[model samples]
Target: MSRTRFKVILYLDETEFSRAAAIYSAILMMNMPNMHLTIVRLKESNQSLLEIDEKCQNIWPTTSDVPQNALDVFLARSKDVQQQVLYSNPNIPDAVTALLAYVNKWAIDLIVMGAGEFSKIKEVIFGSLAYSLQNRSPIPVLLVKELSQDFLEGCNLTPTLTIVPKNQHGN
Candidate 1:
């Protein structure tokens, strides 16, 4: 008999929200024995899909082979995670469409992302990535917003695992 594993996709980027998402993904996957984690990054540029994939692969190294310089230490605790990169047109519609396609292609069981550190005004004008993904994605999304000091203390996380909140502009 074959066993089915839960596929968890984490939206990754250089944002605090993404860091929160990574933390949530790592902890969740670590607790679930039959889970597969994949960190997905989307680039909004004119780059071809092939080029985007290559770049993503470079940045999205697997847990075992991930370089020491990678920012998220939570991921290194688990060795079963992988990475993927997708590219889309700079437009909102196109980006959402491409993200949806990846969800379907991977049969992703769950989508996890940061709650986005966008200002209220900016989120209203241009929805944040988490907002966009939540609105358009077919799968359930876990939007991790903050890591309380208590939780970090309980986890006994290292300095590399520390995640601080970004400003409203996500800077």
Candidate 2:
């Protein structure tokens, strides 16, 4: 018998929310046996070496803050997952474009990303990637918020996850 697999991409950035998103993705991957996860981090060309190093340190181990037992399981499941870094300009449009290009190239089935805190003014000046992907992506996108320990302990996921479909607005 053949098994169906899902190709999922986890988008990363330098934010606490992004780290939370990574952890959430790890947990989801643990539960979803048919999922093939890929983590993609976008680094702008203008970022200093130190900044890149910091981000690399945090994301490579997606399970850094997870409990030891859960970390072990997450690590084992992540063996088949891939980590990739894409370099581009430090602009939302450019970053989104790079990710979209990769999504197209990889034929990804879903995109998992964090909804970082961006002010309305900043979002107006520079469009939000989450918003852009919501309107642009052809496949499903999962946006994860920074989850609290209490929430995870209760195993409540609905409050933390937002599923965005192509050209649709998600709350």
Candidate 3:
């Protein structure tokens, strides 16, 4: 059987340090021969989007607070990593919708996003995007824990990994 070609959408946010770390971890653990990565940033305005992308693209993987040891490990292990940037307006629902639209347009096989820190009150009131994506995305959504190196490695061993069809469901 042919190995699956993977398009990994790395969801970027204002908290890019954490996002980059999660992406780094995913890239290292999955280590797919055919994979593409795009860094997505959601903002409150178009201008903010541009600003955020510019700042993020420049600061990522460099100024990012990812540990030096982890950075070394990622660079050494994930040679096939590719990067792209996307921008979207703030509205959480709108941003997610836009992200899903982009994912479908690119025929992305997987989405890798970091689970941001959330207060219990906020989570209870607003809900978690990661949780929502796991249940709602058409394709598999890998919600990563901050600086967790073993998560994707665990995913790699799971049997019968399902690839949801494009038209199967709407996120």
Candidate 4:
């Protein structure tokens, strides 16, 4: 769809890595003012939604511990921002079902997450969270490696895939 009104869900969970996703989302938001961003903060069973909400409400107005924290606080205050706790469960491969449901309900264009590198063999055997989303998500799933300035120019990207199909002649 158009980047002007792109709907993005920054998948933030318990991982310290989620900060990267938040920063990436913020950059994209800044670049495209019309872009609608929803921060999905995934909390574990130890935290109640009430507790999380209370803490966020407190922090959004007062938190300036870090640049990322301040950015998140500002984002939380923005009218476009939608903070969803989703469940008592944590953000894992198991959470994909709930996330997919949300994606369908809101028509999310993309799911941006911070993914830690894993061995191919490990992923093939046990599977990883990122791969799980990649395989399952109907919409595009972005696993942020590093922030790029390309997003600053509205990300006019046309990705090229290496895979090619054989012709009827089987060249």
Stretch of 10 with least lDDT, candidate 4: 57-66
lDDT of 4 by residue, 50-152 (tens): 2234345222321222135427534543765655656545545646666777788879999988787789998887776777887899999988765455643
Candidate 2 vs. truth: CA RMSD?
Answer: 10.2
Ranking by lDDT: 2, 1, 4, 3
Tell me each candidate's TM-score.
0.72, 0.71, 0.58, 0.63
Model number with the top lDDT: 2
**Candidate 4 Cα RMSD (Å):** 12.4
Location of the lowest summed lDDT over 10 successive residues in candidate 1: 62-71
Q: What is the C-alpha local distance difference test score of candidate 1?
A: 0.66
How well is each residue in 21-49 modelled by candidate 1, as lDDT tens digits? 66666667546656778777777667643
lDDT of each: 0.66, 0.69, 0.57, 0.62
Q: Is candidate 2 or candidate 4 better by lDDT?
A: 2
lDDT of candidate 3 over 1-171, digit per residue (tens): 344666676665546445544546544444554564554555465543232234444334543544454444445434444444555566565566666777777798788777767788997789776666666689988765564446535444221234666565553
CA error at residue 3 for candidate 2, angstroms:
1.3
